[model samples]
Target: MNRRVKEGTYKGKKFNAICHFFGYQARGSLPSKFDCDYAYVLGHVCYHILAAGLNGYMATITNLRNPVNKWRCGAAPITAMMTVRRWSQNPGTASIGKPAIHPATVDLKGKAYELLRQNATKFLLDDIYRNPGPLQFDGPGADSKAVTLCVEDQDYMGRIKKLQEYLDKIRTIVKPGCSQEVLKAALSVMASVTEVLSVMSSSPINGQSSL
Candidate 1:
């Protein structure tokens, strides 16, 4: 073990810099309902992923807002989630950096963030805190989901499947024998949709969108 070279005020210390220990603050022992349930389900998913001999894959559980029985489990390749970054020392010059997985950041524009921002001051200053006690596995609060999950319609894969269903329906409805009005309406709507999607598609390029 290394000892302090000289204990008096240390070397090159900033006059205004300070540090504080946070171990005692926010140290309630109870786990939240969402954390308990999410971990339990993901544990099972991880076991199945292992039993299937998957390598370089991350276990996933979706539809957290739904009942536990309704949740979907799957595994995704680690490579598919990585982003290849480009490093540039100068504005017009660049070099390729290694691919890495970046943690998902909260969207400041998202509804959950907006809700938290609106209540943040009150939450900090008001004596309105309520403890949820220990995590519940069966009764009242057991099925509770995260605030973000409740605020955002985050059934992503479910929405994708629904979109595919709609596309299939459209295909069936817009065949050669369809009415002229039906064809015209589909053509108009699809043209507008395609134009908007094309504009969005052209505006981005870094790596695959985060799941």
Candidate 2:
């Protein structure tokens, strides 16, 4: 219900949809989308994982065929990831967190920085333009979100090892051989059992789950 919830959610979803659509349109395939490290790229891939996994659980990969059936309807509480603070340089309060840009990390973007250099004439140029804007909460664009959630069912390295195993296991329960009703139940159960642990290496809690 909060304005930030709507804005943040809309911003995240629109960014992902446009990014994936353009990528797929260009490459005629979609991979790396499954495990992009960039926040924006990762968000799209995560939604696919969530939606597809949910559907595969539901025995309905057909929804993915539509590419518009995976819309996430809930908004995470903004408080969980943000804080407001006052600063002397500017008299107003500011919301600060990992989302804020840092000049120091510019070089870390690596190849992505290269893309801008190569395409700056086109990307940074004016006149030739297309802005899809925040997608309307209806139609094909409404489905995915840019927000990246770490579900943590399996460890990153562990999951890569087991993804093939799990993918195989899921195929049997989903698709033509199994019932959709049962698949939904299966996916939900698996996701619940495999939630990412709240490991805070920065704090004393370390491996323990934060309350």
TM-scores of the models, in the order given: 0.66, 0.22
lDDT by residue (31-121, candidate 1, tens digit) is 6767777888889889998899989998887777777777777888897766656566888886657666855887899999999999999
Cα misplacement distance, residue 49 of candidate 2 (Å): 24
The residue pairs that clash in candidate 2, if any, are 12-146, 57-183, 57-184, 58-184, 71-143, 152-195, 152-196, 153-194
Q: Top lDDT: which candidate number?
A: 1
lDDT of each: 0.76, 0.42
Counting clashing residue pairs in each candidate, in order, gives 0, 8
lDDT of 2 by residue, 156-191 (tens): 333454778987977776776677788788878777
